[model samples]
Target: MDTSAAARASVCRLPRSVVTSVHTPVSPVGRHLVLMALCFPSASMCPKGCICQRDPHLHSLNVTCSQSRLKEIPPTLPVDAVLLRLDHNQIGAVPDQAFRGLRVVRELNLSYNAVETLGEGAFIGLEESLQVLDLSHNHITRVHRDVFARLKARVIVDDNPWHCDCALQQAISGMAHNHEAAARVLCRSSDLLDQDGRPFLAVEIDLCNLAKRTTDYAMLVTMFGWFAMVISYVVYYVRQNQEDARRHLEYLKSLPSKPKKPDEADDISTVV
Candidate 1:
């Protein structure tokens, strides 16, 4: 992209907002139309330097708007694009409907950006098509658990200063736990030197949750043990009472009827 051959960057001004500068040889109304066309549009509708290609592998589309000093995501993108690479930019925040239209994007590379926080529903519609999400080398500390809760992607979240706490532990809990996402999650605490080189998934995080589970299990076992002891004591007492009753019945049977012989002896004495 040289100076002479470069299409003159026109400032597309809208009613309230200012659209980005792109190579356009048309009126302001045409530039506004150009800006509007980028939203869920064709590859030919992208700005000057954006690279677009059809998905040769999956028969979709691929769009790349990388490192053009972009402070924002290019709004106009092909709807059926499967791969969108926007690496090495200054995209600070992701708005709510930024990626809502990209329903089939699989590999999204937003690495080396200034993304601090993603808005609510920022990735709402991407649960199905998103496969590989790269958010490495950014300024993100805490993220919503539902951001990657349903996506089955190889999420790259390395090189960010992560605070290992309960919120993060809950986010990566079930099928959402991407190993690479946890593999390089660096600790942020200065006093936490023991966990410096270790990944967040390997250390006390799993053990911490496991310890909680083990504690619950131990309580359950203790309750069962107490119930068993009470049952055993009741059974022992019942058997002992049964034995005592048997012994009393045997003593009563062994006590002879002594008076029966005494009656005949008395009658004989009276006759004499």
Candidate 2:
């Protein structure tokens, strides 16, 4: 807008108390017009490729700045705007207070981006009207356990590489039983192996707990247990079998040789 038109637009909305310097008009209407021009000289000029007018798409969704080459989130956003779409961008990390004054934001779509990590308590103090959250197709590895505790809406976090190690045990466990709150979640990890080829993510608790309990004292107890039970059983079994074989040999030697004596008695009777 031109200077004259810009001045008129800014001054037309101010209260009736402030005075003007551009024109010394005596009437109340003229006075308010000049006063607004003096206070805010540049309120009508919109950003490049963006308008300062109210948005008509979503009643609450006023401002939209998507599909841009923005590396970081813009600092100046409309506080009252509700729905925001920041898809298909190169935004790697979001500041905790990026949506500082946006208390009316309801649906947020941050999908198809390069968001690698989320800060803790990132969405701590959000608009109570927020209902749907979409963070799909990002480079996110793990969601902090207590990050979504304050959110009072449904969250969708699928198709991301989730690290299910000890560092991520709490997050995976939380999502497993989130049948009532969290929906359609998928967390993939190296430590999680399915025994029955099922798609369910499994935790190796036995391996985890055993490694944790392997102190010097515990190792000594486990080592001695195997030696005592295994060695004792084998030695006892071999000794019992040897004793039974010796008894059988002695019984066979005790038989007498009486056949040779009968043949000698018959020969002596014939000679007499």
Tens-place lDDT per residue, model 1, 144-218, is 655667677788888877766555666667344576566667766422347655667666546446657877999
Tell me the spans in candidate 2 whose CA falls farther than 4 Å from its real position.
1-61, 166-169, 172-183, 194-272
- Candidate 2 lDDT by residue in tens digits, 42-151: 32332233333344333343444567766666676656556667777788977686667768878777788888878765676573766876777888876676566566
TM-score of 2: 0.53
Q: After superposition, how far is residue 110 of candidate 2 from its true place, in Å?
A: 0.6
State model 1's lDDT: 0.71
Off by over 4 Å in 1: 1-41, 55-58, 174-177, 190-197, 205-272
How much is 4 displaced in model 2, in angstroms? 18
lDDT of 2 at 10: 52
In model 2, the Cα lDDT at residue 30 comes to 59
Show the colliding residue pairs in model 1.
Answer: 38-76, 39-76, 55-60
Best by lDDT: 1
